[model samples]
Structure formats: structure tokens, C-alpha cells
Target: ESAEEVIGELRPLLKGILREDKKSIPDMNEDEKIMHGCLESKPKHIDSITRAIQMTPGKALSVLLSLELKGLVRQSDGKHFSLH
Candidate 1:
């Protein structure tokens, strides 16, 4: 199979791992800590969130998108995000 096919096969397993990792954490995880950090202050754009969360832009967006998918955060105007 091609690389794309391999990735497609791994997608569901990766998602399951992420979900399980989210549940199994003892304390706030990097993602949750970032979420709470945003919640403590005003709503922020992705760039600001990256700075506030102290993570790379790609990593920050990934975490924020994950949160948005989980319904923990909402984005309005497709720019800013805040806790739901």
C-alpha cells in the first residue's frame, strides 16, 4: 500500500490513542493546561494562544483544534476561540 493508505489505516488508531491519553492523565495535560490558561484570561486568537501556551504554532493549532472538536472550545468568526 501507499503512504496515504498507511496513514488512513493509522488514523482511527491514533484518534483512539489520543482519546485514551486524554482520559488517563492524572493531572492537567499540556492540552488541558493550555485550555485552562486561555480560560483564565480573555479570549485569544491562535497566534496569541500559541504564545500564551508556550508551544509551537503547529502544536498549538493541533491542540486547539482537538479542543474545538471535543466541544470544549468554540470559535467564532473562524479566528478567535474561547471556552464553551
Candidate 2:
């Protein structure tokens, strides 16, 4: 499956893991919390995902590229990504 698909599949898993491990989700904004929850469960660090979560759409794309290069995530067939 593509990265986006992977992320979509993994998102809930990540959230579940975080909720289980941390006892509570990070007190971030909705977008930030979603992104943090996603990354916190990954095997590797994902700065791009964090940046994307924090910045505008244009910057988020840049962050996505960076995250891809870092091998923390993979790009989907479209505008999506999955953790590696």
C-alpha cells in the first residue's frame, strides 16, 4: 500500500497506542495533536510531519518532502504519507 494508505491505516492505531502509553494525549491543537499522535507511535522521528502539522499547506508539503528524505515516512500516490 502507498504511504497515504499506510498513514490512514496507522492513524487510529497510533492514536490508540498513544492513548494507552501516555495515558493522555498531548495537549496540542486539533491538528497538532493528530500529527503528534501519529508520529509518537512511529519507529522513527518525523520532523516533517510535525512541521506539516504546525505550518500552512505549502510549508507542510515541504515538511513532507523532508520527512520522506529522512526515511521517517513515504509519500503516497497522491498528497498523503505513511510512517516507515
Candidate 3:
């Protein structure tokens, strides 16, 4: 088969597999909740994230630290955070 034909044939199967994988992904946890509070492409202040997630500042900071250590989040100067 030509490359295009092979890709066309595989496209549906690949999409199905991706759908299954997405379904299998577990729900967000504590760190994920905090991460979700921040914008994916923009940094947000710690206070804003905390309030957005409705978490205590201390607890949000703790979870943010965990996310940072796990390489899922990046912290900029002045307590700003965004998805890494």
C-alpha cells in the first residue's frame, strides 16, 4: 500500500485507540486540581489560582509545590504558576 493509503486505513483505528486512552485517563487529583486552576498558556498568581480552585492558600501552595516537583507545573517569580 502507498503511505497515504496506509495512513488512511489506520486513521480510524488510531482515533479509536486515542479515544479509549483518553477515557482511561484517571480523574484529576489534588495537584491536578491546583494545576487546572492556572491557565495552560499563561502564568497566574498563587492567590488567583487558590481562589479559582476554592482551596486554602496553604493547601494550594502545597499542591502546587508537589506539581512543580513532578514537572507538571512551572513557578515563575512572584508566586506565579503555569502548566509546564
Candidate 4:
């Protein structure tokens, strides 16, 4: 078969695979969403996450630690946070 024909046949299969992958991802809680949004594109400092979340830096750090425990994020060099 031509490459175009092969690609056309795979299109539906690929879409199914993508949909399954989306379904396998677990839902996030509100705190997790707050942290997730702050970590978009690049890692962030404690102060930065606090600013984005509109909470105290200490409270933001607590939320970040919880997210880390949930396997949704990580802290590096004891300063920055990012998606895992």
C-alpha cells in the first residue's frame, strides 16, 4: 500500500490510542491543579508558586510537598518545583 493509504488507515487507530492514554491519566485535585499550572513550561521557585496560587509561601510549599508525594511533581535542589 502507498504511504498515504497506510497513514489513512492508522489515523483512527492513533486517535483511539490517544483517547485511551487520556483516560489512563488520573484526575487531579484543586491543590494539584494549582501546583500544576504553576509548573507549566518550566520549574518554579517557592515564591513563584506562592504568587501564582495566591497563598502564603509556607502553605504553597505544603501543597507542593503533597503533590510530590502523589507522584505528580518533584522538588529539585530543595528550591524549585516541577512536574514529574
Candidate 5:
């Protein structure tokens, strides 16, 4: 599937999950909440994934690399990632 398609699929899933988690537990920072949600869901193209959860480009790239190493995602291109 295309990168955009992958991103489209992940977006709502991430949002829904994050929203539910936020309602259940409070006091998490946006990035921490997003990172936790993403890790749990194993979404694709997460480096480029932006929403209520935002990060610096460098931090986002680092998270992507870490996820790749953990086998949750695969590097599809220099600029894209896919759930594995």
C-alpha cells in the first residue's frame, strides 16, 4: 500500500485509542501519551504521524528508529515506515 494509505489507516485507530486512554488515565504529556499509544498500536509511518501529539523532527525520527529496532515497524524508504 502507499504511504498515504498506510498513514490514513493508522490515524483514526491511533486517535481513538489515545482518546480512550486519556479518559481512563490523566496527567500524561502529549508526546508521552502519543508515544505510548503508538507503541501499543504499532502504527505505520509514525515518524510522520502528527496530531494532538507533536514532536520535533529529530525526536520523531528517533522514535521511528527505536520502533524499527524493536521490530514493530519496517523501514520502507528513507522517508517512510510500515507496520511489520
Candidate 6:
């Protein structure tokens, strides 16, 4: 198949997978903990999140990055984050 045809065929499946993933919360404890630390509408600083989640900044950053990739969180202003 041509590149466009392959992409077109995969697009719907990819979209369905992505939509299903987003509908379910991550099962990891760290992910859930950090997610709770993020405010619903107000962006919070990394330091505040770390404190609230009681995780080392490095570990929290790692979890936050994972959450960002999962489309459940958004990072802003370099060090701030909020639920997406």
C-alpha cells in the first residue's frame, strides 16, 4: 500500500486507542498521586506538586512527563502543570 493509504487505514484505530486510553485513569500509584496534586483549572508550580505528592522532585518530574505523554496533564510556564 502507499504511505497515505497505510496512514489512512491506521488513523481510525489509533484514534480509538487514544480516546479509550484517555477515558481511563492511569493505574500507576505515582501517576494517580501526581495527578491529584495538579489542580483542576489552576496551574501549580513543580515545587508545590512535589510537596503535595511527597515525592522527590526528580521522581515527580518523571511521573509528570509520563502523564503529559498520556494526554492527562499539561505543563506550562516551564515548571507549572495542570489537568488537561
Ranking, lDDT, top scorer first: 6, 4, 3, 1, 5, 2
Tens digits of per-residue lDDT for model 1, 10-46: 9999999999778443355677665656753346787
The sequence of per-residue lDDT tens digits that candidate 2 reaches over residues 1-84 is 999999999999999888788743223444433543465333433346545456566655565566556555566554555655
- Lowest summed lDDT over 10 consecutive residues: which window, candidate 1? 23-32
Q: Choose the strongest candidate by TM-score.
A: 4
Residue-by-residue lDDT tens digits, candidate 3, 1-84:
899999999999999999988834335686676466565768899888877877788888888777777676788999898887
Residue clash pairs of candidate 1: none
- Return the lDDT, model 6, position 80: 95
Report the lDDT tens digits of candidate 6 across residue range 10-75: 999999999988867665575666455565668889898888767789988888888787777888
Which rank order by TM-score, best down to worst?
4, 6, 3, 1, 5, 2
Better of 3 and 4 by TM-score: 4
The TM-scores of all predictions, comma-separated, are 0.54, 0.38, 0.59, 0.62, 0.42, 0.60
- The runs of at least 3 residues in candidate 3 whose Cα sits more than 4 Å from the true structure, single-residue gaps closed, are 1-28
Q: Give the range where candidate 4 is weakest over 10 consecutive residues by summed lDDT.
A: 23-32
**Candidate number with greatest lDDT:** 6
- Candidate 3 has a TM-score of 0.59
- The whole-model C-alpha lDDT of candidate 1 against the native structure comes to 0.71
Provide the overall lDDT of each model, using Cα atoms, as 2-decimal numbers. 0.71, 0.56, 0.77, 0.79, 0.59, 0.80
Would you give me the overall lDDT of model 6?
0.80
Residue-level lDDT of model 5, residues 1-84, one tens digit each, is 999999999999999889887833334445544654654333345444643257776776676666556555566545555555
Q: Single out the weakest 10-residue window by summed lDDT for candidate 3.
A: 23-32
Where does candidate 1 stray beyond 4 Å?
Answer: 1-28, 40-42
Is candidate 1 or 5 superior in lDDT?
A: 1
Clashes per model (N, Cα, C within 3 A): 0, 0, 0, 0, 0, 0
User: In candidate 6, where is summed lDDT lowest over 10 consecutive residues?
Assistant: 30-39
Sequence-dependent TM-score of model 6: 0.60
